[model samples]
Target chain A: MTLLKNIWEWDKRNFERLRRFQLPHRFKQIGFALFLVAFLALLAFRFVNNDATVIKTSLKYILLIGLLIISVSKEKIEDERIVQLRQQSYQVAFVVGVLYSILILPLVNYMADVIFKKESLGFEVNSWEVLFIMLLMQWFIFRMMRKKCS
Target chain B: MKNTLKVERAILNLTQDELAKEIGVSRQTINSIETNRYVPSTVLALKLSELFKKPVNDFFTLEEND
Candidate 1:
């Protein structure tokens, strides 16, 4: 129980003025953990079935969104170290995502033209990877703006 | 912004929590204002002055540069 409480406290974080977000955070975390376990299970049984691949892809997105929601609840963080870590981690994610997207465009082209010699196939830019990039970018921008304004 | 909040609260013998509950804000907000970490909005400033039975200017000041 003490260990579990420690994890929950870390995840929910401290609110500067109020602890209003704690209840919703606990529920979000439960859902997030469930999604993560299912996602990992799907990964473990990858060779079991073809349908599992499709299910995994979709579940990946749902898991990403759930984690994003839990991570971005605006709980009014007060600890300076946590704030700095969050700011830097988000910046790194955003930079990597943008670089990956830029590289993917050219890399995918090269793969279709020179490497695989297959017909060009466009993918859904709204896929989980793209959504992850966007969420990271959002976090970076939010933290930067918060730092500048308040 | 300049404020005489600590002075007024001291006169009224109101603890930060009591003042916060009376003003519908959290104790942290009161603490922030008292420590000059944050400035309250106009409505909140007025409410606090009214609660202390003082003129708004008694609690707030407008610097010439502000």
Candidate 2:
């Protein structure tokens, strides 16, 4: 029991330490700039050479990394309340993102199949797309909650 | 939980922004606490108590639902 208690304490201490792991506030702007540039590059690549799957995949990963930087960066005022909101936003976004993948995407695919009067195209949602959705949703919900609280 | 933070701040003639600055928090945090939309952590509650020069219980009290 003492050994188990020690392990629990160590885990808790590490978790608390993780709470302080955030980039400085300026990284938020830099992250957004990176995301924007990668997004435009991806669009231009799609227009120019849609067959370059490797390059497209690489750009998508860069976009995901940019979003991750933004998500993990501190706000201008890194208060406890903002931290709480960020946690809440992440939780909500994960649930919503899963529901979107399981329910909304399939529903849309079915609707498209019916409307187009074509056979099912077996549309698959990419993992990167889901991550993008979750991050965007988290940001939107966090901003809305902040605005309402303010 | 409910708190008399707004009333206490008013008595001291301190705006939300000023109180937040004193506590090293955002103005929105003060607003959230005043509006009863957020319950501060023990550290924050202690900070407020220290700032107001009162016991934590003087400003913060438990509701029956809490």
Candidate 3:
């Protein structure tokens, strides 16, 4: 039992140490700005060139890359409080995303029924949109929690 | 949980930045602790205790609700 406790303590310490190698706060800030600009530019281009298949194909990738950079960005102080907030954010994102998806099932069905005026409109929710929503939600929640916690 | 971090820092004549640098954390972390907005981890609490030359309990105390 003592040996097991010691091993657990050692592992916990190692895990905490590993959390310190996050991107520098300034780098994260710059990345956030750059990615936001790139994403918005791509989005505007897609709007202007609505029929461009290449734009349509690349939009999701751009959004994903932007979201990834934003999510990985560290706060000004990457302390234990911020780490706790990050964990909370991921948990909140997953649970809320699943619930939101479930709720959207009926929403899509209703939209198909009313708007399309067809028995089976065959509407599909874009998987990329779901992922984007999840990441956005996590980032928002993490920011709020970090502010509240710290 | 509540802490006497501000008082302890005063006793040692250490600024928040200095204490934070000594412990390898940002100054905002020390400010948060001083303001009772954030709780330090066990490792951090121990480090603070070591720096202050006192027991951890001397700086931090559990409230009734805790």
Candidate 4:
């Protein structure tokens, strides 16, 4: 019983450690460079080939991964102010994202009817688009607010 | 809230980086507090108090707007 208890405590500590873990500054910098290059390369390929299928499949994955790296990476000095800004970013991103999701359906319908001239409207929105937009908003707002605050 | 953190640090002859190290926070945090751009938490306030050998109220006080 004591051994089991010790194991549980150790596992709990490890879980907490993992929960608070962040990548080193150098690794994050390298990740930023690599992802930027990959994104530009993919974009150029899409522009040249004009392949809708390939672009639809691979572009989003690179975007999602790059956004994840941006969000997860730590600053040179991750202090209380930065943490507060992060909280603000999350709150703003969530509210904006939900509002966008609500408004986008009607906008999409309008676009389909007027722009696309489609008779049959089966409006299905992609979830990744919303996620990407939310991530972009978070990044933009966080940077802007941080700049104003600091 | 308003604080005399810059004055206190000056009295102690401590740089922002040194004070931040003693307080287990980043230098930018100390700078922010000094510039009145950010407020420290209760625990951080107490830590500053302990480091400066002064009461929390001596370092921080409420302004009319606060």
**Residue A26 local lDDT, model 4:** 63
Model 1 C-alpha lDDT per residue in residues A75-124, reported as the tens digit of each score: 34333333444566577767767766777755776677776777765542
TM-score of each: 0.48, 0.86, 0.76, 0.80
Spell out the clash pairs found in candidate 4: none
Candidate 1 structure quality by residue, lDDT tens digits, B1-66: 777888999999989889987977666667767766566777788888789988888888877778
On the 0 to 100 scale, the lDDT of residue A31 in model 4 is 55
Better of 3 and 4 by TM-score: 4
Task: For candidate 2, write residues A44-105 as lDDT tens digits.
Answer: 98679558888788888889888888898899999999988999999999999999888888
**Candidate 3 backbone collisions, by pair:** none
For candidate 2, what is the lDDT? 0.89
lDDT of each: 0.66, 0.89, 0.80, 0.82
**In model 1, which regions exceed 4 Å deviation?**
A1-51, A67-127, A133-150
Show model 3 residue runs off by greater than 4 Å: A1-34, A108-112, A115-124
Comparing 3 with 4 on DockQ, the higher-scoring candidate is 4
> Which segments of model 4 are wrong by more than 4 Å?
A1-4, A50-56, A119-123, B13-18, B21-24, B63-66
lDDT of 3 by residue, A1-150 (tens): 999999999999999988655666666666567557767777687668467767656765766776777787787767776777788899999887776676775578778789878786344566776787788899889878766655
Provide backbone clash counts, one per model. 0, 0, 0, 0
lDDT of 4 at A125: 58
What tens digits encode model 2's per-residue C-alpha lDDT throughout B1-66? Answer: 889999999989999999999999999889989989999999999999998899999999999988
Candidate 3 is scored at a TM of 0.76
Chain B TM-score against the true chain B, each candidate: 0.88, 0.96, 0.96, 0.96
Pitting candidate 1 against candidate 3, the one with the higher TM-score is 3
